[model samples]
Target chain A: MSQTVKKTFRCHPEPDECKGCGRCVSACPKKLLKLGSALNIMGVPYAEYSGEGCVGCGACFYTCPEPGAITIYEITPEA
Target chain B: MAEVVKFGRPKGFFETFERRPGSIKKNMSYCPGCGHGVLHKLIAEAMADFGIQDKTTFISPVGCSVFAYYYFDCFGLQVPHGRSAAAATGLTRANPDSIVIGYQGDGDLAAIGFNAFMQAANRGENYCVFFVNNAIYGMTGGQMAPTSLLGQKTATSPYGRNALTEGYPLKISEMVSQLESPVYVERVALTTPANIMKARKAVRKAIQINMEKKGFAFVEVLSGCPVNLKMKPADMDKFIDENMTKYFPLGVYKDVTAEREPVVRPVPTFEKADVEKALYRELPGGDQEHESCDSEIFNRELRIKIGGFGGQGVLSLGLIMAAMGKYRNLNVSWLPSYGPEMRGGTANCAVIVNKGPIGSPIVDSNCDLLVVLNRPSLDKYLPELGENGVLMYDSSTIKEVPAVKPGQKAIALNTGDIAEEFGNLKCANAVMLGAIGAMLTKHYLTPADAAKFQETAEAAIAECFAGKDKIVKMNIEACKLGFDKMQAAL
Candidate 1:
């Protein structure tokens, strides 16, 4: 028998690196990304995460054109 | 607790793009949602994962992706428009262990550099070529490219590309797969998530083949040009899937990678001696640069002009004189000017000998010695003689004797008559050379140099006709006869 483990997958989008093409918003399977209304340093709307429903499929990471615009993280909880 | 980065920038890319200009080097200069950025990311990932980043070299084409060197961590080379494939072939041949990748656009590869790319492919160069087909030319303000669809409208094709005029779109993957040399050929699109996954796989597979040293792998990527096509990011994908894919299908056209062996070409030699041998440089005499001259005439700058008909050997006579200067340990320059005809036309040459360095090979004016073989040459070049210049003429060809200036001396020799009497009429230039030797001994050269003039003339004749024993002997006899005749006349 295996014990249940809790894990957290985070989608981190760098606002300064993002060109706000909205590709990640469409690529997300959970529909948790949005083109933010507030402008970033680039003076354009940047992609934002809903901070809840990231499954870490890496669709957003692959869709974003900029090299370091988006990154996915996997965090495992301790027993 | 454990934390890991599931997806991030590949290590193949620089930690910071130092090659890129300006402060904000984190992002590429490509437009937002550009297909080149996506492809760059895929290639960077493949380069890192395959562990060929250090050994890999990327040839950037002349398009929007010309700045690929700014992003790649490994070696990067920028080639002229559409010449990346040719440059990649050289890089691969020079360094067989290194991986070469040629990045090109539709305008560059298909339109401008099609022949170079095709020849490299046919030769089975050990390199992977990534051909990006974005329907239209994206770099030069959306011009119509060879891969552009018939109905597609571009800057040059304003009225929507006509089937009668623009022709059908080129299926590069299909064309490349037809060639037997290419080991792998695939057409992948950057449209849907599934399609992008396929493209990612194709990119990795091509680079893998390069790592294995497979011969000629080609991947035609159906990319998007959102800004140039005036479409949004999401719509661009739909356009490529629906419209472009109809013309250029997305699939693997050929995959003989499993059956093919690694290519092994002969390594090129870079040794200095080997290179000099390959260039056909004479290896016997090392350096003949001498500082001092034994002759007084060689101590100052001496400009000699020899003019005649083409068949009179005027140029060869100038060469012999220049060779004499070379033997005397002086700097010499020979400049030959001739008409288009090989024979019967005018020919002239200037031989300049100097103790110091020669400023120019041209002897347009202020000639110290003028040797004319024909009447026309004598009449044309007489005025160019400087003060106290020696004017020598073949009296057999010229009827009238030219009047000499206050200090100048005019010497006449029956060069043609002497050449015929000696052996062959073609040796008239040799007779003239002997006469020139006799005149220098009497007037210009010192006693010690005068004694060596005959030996120098014989040596110059031997050098000019090297390996031709009969011609060397006959010309030396002809030179001695003309020398004896000139000494008696003087």
Candidate 2:
């Protein structure tokens, strides 16, 4: 079989105001985001992207209410 | 006649065009003419159309539409009534990359779960909360709900609900729109073709906004509960628009931004020692000592009940006790039944603390200790006390003595009178808590544990009283009195 194409989407959180309320994880159509082990400036859990099968639909970025808390980017084959 | 012709499948058919890989292929469990079915269908179609079905996480609530998991192809959670918002908050926060939809009914949204719902909106938690408003409580046999329209009658309201006595129906869409954090708030009805089209547009726009990761978005659909409304399916549109729409108006309430951001939260990996040092703290006792106490207490179970006047701290006491149980490393659960009983003039709560996981949060009958703050509570639940159970009550107001079953121990103390003497009438609950702690010493909880519980109780009470110090002090003393009395009785 041909090499399976895989894409990775990630969310970056702002350390100051992420309250750790997990709305983005539930809002993603790809089910790729989750609360990461890292703590923000306020010491709350922030969203983390771990799954490799991201469609880049921007659902997580759109559904996240915290500005600059969630950053979505796609990882292509070369990366 | 023109010749009939069929076109062949287009190129890249599997890759470019297909039904959403995540949507389930099954009929919904909603009733005929129920707006939930239509709304679910619309959402599924939208997800499929957008090719993001595999990424959605649907949060379902208790109501006529509780079985939403069976219909959605994505991961689904059937949450408790009014808790879908909180659950969605957890699920979405845990999986910010998934499409989360919090679905609930009017009773679930407006009455029981309003606080969580409002908090989520105020914080602008990213997700779409679709509230289905069908004037009456359809799943609970057409009871009058917070959103039940004035002048409408239901099981509880024999006559039409009077605005003067029952209060006007809550406009949830309007209420949610008033919050600053929410980016989009709209009310749409599924009554007629025109209204359906409007609702479809609103749904699409809300979903699109959610996809954009802008802010909190909500859509309230004024749906028809034909069976509960005593109307036929054919007349649902007329009934909803004429009666329901008049009470719950339809329109877009708020939309903050046009542009969207990419949603992503950063991940931090931590060492085991760092995690332990960060979460664990030194309390009154040393860390090792406390750890051993935790293990020992975690192996024991305790059930305590609190009953008193409506204004008394019955529910608060139960919560504090539950908190103490948690502090002791035991599994804890607290439940209260106070609406009609308290309104009819009484208050009560059941708290279960166990070493292992609890089977049910609700108690049908029998408890380890019955703490009665008033005569009615004593009379009502006194018989349900388990054999060898201890009964504690305030001696001040309870003048008439009712005969008890043999071998049941009843201790009467002037808790309310003592609380009044202590200068805080609300301390009656604290007194009961102290008595419970003293009586259940065999369960391995200490006076310090009880005091810690009291502190939590005081904090909650302060919030309720808007930070009143005198009330907190009085309740604290009442707790002391109960502890002292329980010692004397034991």
Candidate 3:
């Protein structure tokens, strides 16, 4: 059987659209996400991906109902 | 004993009294008579009393108590309203040594947080939940909450809540106590001195149990909201005595201490090999097969809608149908529309079964099959069905409705009457499920697959009627009757 490679992904939050609702924080299966002080172009507090021991369950990506607020993609070996 | 010689005061002598070394010390912004303040104080006092202040972690909700981190002298996380239980579950599961407290209000606990609360309780996570029942939405300015008593007026209920119109208040404490996983479940009040004493004892016992690393523990506190109720301090006691106590009586609903000795969870060791072995043991092949199958099915989609009254088992029926589709190796998804409108109003659920990966679970406009339980549900969703879709309804209640557009197939079944003839009113949902099963099984499942569906339905029936086999028999008959009716109609 081939081993399934485990990968890590970082979710970037658009501060302009974030209401600091903490929906992503609650939906994260790994609990590695937190609200950061850094403001985005819209001056709102965006979600900071801690990426500390993330399981990559994509629970946050699936449960987040906000459109264009949460952008998630894989962090390749080069990056 | 000899007198101890003291040098200059120790460097950390005042540190003990200053504040919890790791906890929060900020003053909270909760209003007076708001249960959140009292609950915060009780939780903080519990942590201090147990000497776990530094190790305690508090999970805050979104309502008036959203600023729970302000008062607690410990690590705190301000989470979304109604999701504190879920967050605390995650935190406690990851760091089992830390004392996790989930603090939530009536609106957050009973309204939008129902699924999270139920799933957590069902899992029996090692966390203490302090449910503060204020009956009205305080943060949102007196909106009707799930715990709002019948005939009670709120911002949304200008006229008193009518049972026939608005439905009854949800008894969450009693509901949670019914689950088998909870180690302790109790309801206490802070209205009077006697009640407050009981509440303190309950809170203390809950904290002590947490310190012992026990399983799930819950305490529902019947609290007051003077600002929301618009009641004077002097009238608060009378209001609670006359109004609140009638709906939320305080008592211990479940305590399993006498039944068995406490089971201690093994301290987790940090070993990559152990983690890998345990992960593989728990999830052997992973869920890749299930995911890939669902993706394949989603790649050819079909949308189906099922509607009925609140207690007619519409949601479960829809789930069973979706589960059957999954068992037959089809892609399936189910979503239930529930809330206040479900009590006296029509209830419905949407299921999307496909051959490939599906796009959305929510049914917005187009649907293939519309199963209506009542006239109102039919009237509400009839137009949303596509021109080629089939519409089915319970004929017992619905007599007349607006004309259906051409190209849509409409069929009515006397489901309630059929269930009554079978001597059970609850089996109408089973009948509808059987009907839907007969129609969809040919393409997605087999006769054996339908039997598997019936086996599950029967097991659920038997469990629901543990001591009453007659009821189970009647429900089975009802299922058969509905299946035969659909066969004849088709």
TM-score of each: 0.72, 0.47, 0.46
RMSD of 1: 5.6
- Report the CAPRI category for model 2: incorrect
User: How do the residues B398-420 of candidate 1 rate in per-residue lDDT, one tens digit apiece?
Assistant: 87889979999899998998888
| Top-TM-score candidate index | 1
Query: Mind giving the per-residue lDDT tens digits that candidate 3 earns over B29-51?
Result: 44434455445545655676577
In the range B1-490, model 2's lDDT, one tens digit per residue, is 1211111111101221123233322223445346665576566656666766677778878898787666565677888889988987776677776778888898999989999999988877778988899888998899998888888889887798889998999998898888877888899876654566677677777777777777688999888777788875447667777877777778888877565464455433367876655544333221234323343444645566788777777888777777655555455688887866543367778888785668787754667778887788888888778776777777888876656678777777777876787667767777777776566563445655544554554444444455677765666667668778767866
Greater TM-score among 1 and 2 belongs to 1
Alpha-carbon lDDT, every model: 0.88, 0.68, 0.69
* Model 1 complex DockQ against the native: 0.70
Q: Tell me the spans in candidate 2 whose CA falls farther than 4 Å from its real position.
A: A1-79, B1-26, B259-490
Q: Tell me the interface RMSD of every candidate, in Å.
A: 1.1, 19.6, 24.1
Candidate 3 lands at a TM-score of 0.46
By lDDT, is 2 or 3 better?
3
Q: Per-residue lDDT for A1-79 in model 2, tens only?
A: 2367554444454444344545456555567767778876556676676646655554444333332344555554452
True lDDT of residue B422, candidate 1: 71
